[model samples]
Target: MIELTLIGIGTGNPDHLTLQAVAAMRAADLILIPHKGADKDDLAGLRRAICDRYLGASTRVALFDMPQRDPGDPDYHHRVNRWHDRIAAIWQDRIAAELPLLSGKVALLVWGDPSLYDSTLRIAGRLELPLTTRVIPGITAIQALCAAHAIPLNRIGAPVQITTGRQLRDHGWPEAADTIVVMLDGESSFQTLRPEGVQIWWGAYLGMAEELLDHGPLPDAAPRIVATRAAARAAHGWIMDIYLLRRDRDQQAGRA
Candidate 1:
């Protein structure tokens, strides 16, 4: 039986590792780190650094090449599903080759909580081999973004919807929630909404050294956020960001 542990390491900050995450790292027999080419090597490097900080010498660390999506595929979901299957196959092959006996624990460090926007759990489900899975939750980008900005995720009793950039652009604002926290948005999705009554709090690289933050009325902040996001992505070759939006009226009553 292969015991697969998906540990959340939080954003890019080493301090984000929880005690449970550290314990999970130390317990694993082998940990897989995915390399996303030289430009995004910092991602793989961060995982390695986490392992180096917490794992003992007995634990093994291996690097795997992260699969890239085929740009030519017109069907986004189909292409992603196929890509996931390829990744699952890679995981199976690596486990078999590295642990031929197939009795030891294997782990992968994930960004943020696996239960959130991350797809690590979904890909792990594609493993054909008999597998036991365990997840160690860590801070999410939403939480980090809120904490960095010293704002609450939702106003007192109001609901907050967490969504992606596509949803925000394709479906305008959610009716039920006064506040929306967006993740996985490469293009400043807030630009799609009317800036009249919305306030946006944005943060990139939340817990990292190169963190960037901005907030104010949507109209005033949208331009700067887009420009800053572009510059940051260009300088680092990659970026992880999240933002929270709330209608100004929602906060008029002074709710936390």
Candidate 2:
């Protein structure tokens, strides 16, 4: 039986790795790192850095090219499903090649907690191999963002909604939530919202050396964030970012 361990490495910092994650990495018979093309090569490099720091000399490391999702596919869910299916197949191929017997402990370093916005768990489910899956939770970008900003995730007794940029762009603000955390947003979806009483805390490369942060009333920060995000992506060739939006009801009332 193949024991698949999905270890969360947390943002891009090796220091963010938990003791549990380190133990799992050391125990794995094979560790697979995905190459996200030349643009995002740093992603694989970071995973390698983690292994270099934590793993013994005997630990086997394998690298594979990550499949690109077809942006032309108009249906987002369908596109992602197809992409996940491709990734699962690649995992099976890599595992079989490395562990010819097909029975050993395997590990994939995940960004942030696997339970959060990441698709590692979903991709693992698509694997055809008979495997017992395990997760070693690590810090999430949301946690890092909050910690970096030194703020709480929610207001007292208020519910916080976690959503994607697509949801905010398509549905406007969620009616039930005063505080919203937006992830997987390539476009500055906060621009789609009415900025009057909303505050935003935005961070990119949260725990990395090139980390960038901006916050303030949405109206004031939106443009600056867009320009900053664009410049960062151009300089680095890739970017992963998240933002939190909180509507100030008192401020709205005062404005009215």
Candidate 3:
């Protein structure tokens, strides 16, 4: 049976690796690295770096070409489903070819936590084979974002909405929640809001040496953050940034 282990490596920091992840890597019979091409990003290289640092020669390492998703497709959900299927097939092929026996453990180094804004689990589900799949949780960007800014996730008993930038752009702010954490946002979607009583805490390249952070009233901070994010992304060739938007209730009460 294919014993798959999804190992969370944390947000771009090698030191964030947990003991469980390290053990999984050491125990793995084969580790698959996804090659995401050169121009779009260097994440593939980061994955290799992690393996090179932690894995030994005994653990067979294989590189598989990652399929690119089609953004021009009319149906977004359908496109994602098709992309996941293709990825699952590729994983199966690569694993079977490298380790025909499939006797030992298999591991994948996941960026951040697999449960947060990642599709490794969904792809694994399509494996459709009887295999023991284990997930090792790691530090997520949300945690790193809060830590970098020295902010708490939720204020008192208030609720927070965790969403994508696309959703925020299309639906504005959700009335049901006082706070929101946005991920996978290419554009500065927060600017679409009225920005009356909102506070923003933003972070880029979280947990890394070149990390950037900014926080203040949304109206004042949003523009600077956008400029910084754009320039940083251009300089680094890619960027992973997340932000937390909170409405200060005490300030709201004062205004009222």
Candidate 1, 168: how far from true, in Å? Answer: 0.9
Candidate 3's displacement at residue 211, Å, is 1.0
lDDT at residue 220 of model 1 (Cα atoms): 97
Using TM-score as the yardstick, the better of models 1 and 3 is 1
Spell out the clash pairs found in candidate 3.
none
TM-score of each: 0.96, 0.97, 0.94
Candidate 1: tens digits of C-alpha lDDT, residues 1-256: 9999999889979899999999889999999999999999989988888888899998999888888988899998999999999899998889988899988999999999999988899999999888899999988998899899998888788788999998999998887778899988998989988788789999998898899999998989999999999999999999999999998764434342
Evaluated against the true structure, the overall lDDT of model 3 is 0.87
Q: Which lDDT values do the candidates have, in the order given?
A: 0.90, 0.94, 0.87
Our model 3 lands, by Cα RMSD against the true structure, at: 1.9
Task: Write the residue-wise lDDT of candidate 2 on 1-256 in tens digits.
Answer: 9999999999999999999999999999999999999999889999999999999987899999999999999998999999999999999999999998989999999999999988999999999998999999999999999999999999899889999999999998887778999999999999998898889999999999999999999999999999999999999999999999998876534442
lDDT leader: 2
Evaluated against the true structure, the overall lDDT of model 1 is: 0.90
Q: Which regions of candidate 1 deviate over 4 angstroms?
A: 250-256
RMSD of 2: 1.5
Rank the candidate models, highest TM-score first. Answer: 2, 1, 3
For model 2, the run of ten residues with the poorest summed lDDT: 247-256
Clashes of each: 0, 0, 0
What ranges in model 2 sit over 4 Å off?
Answer: 251-256
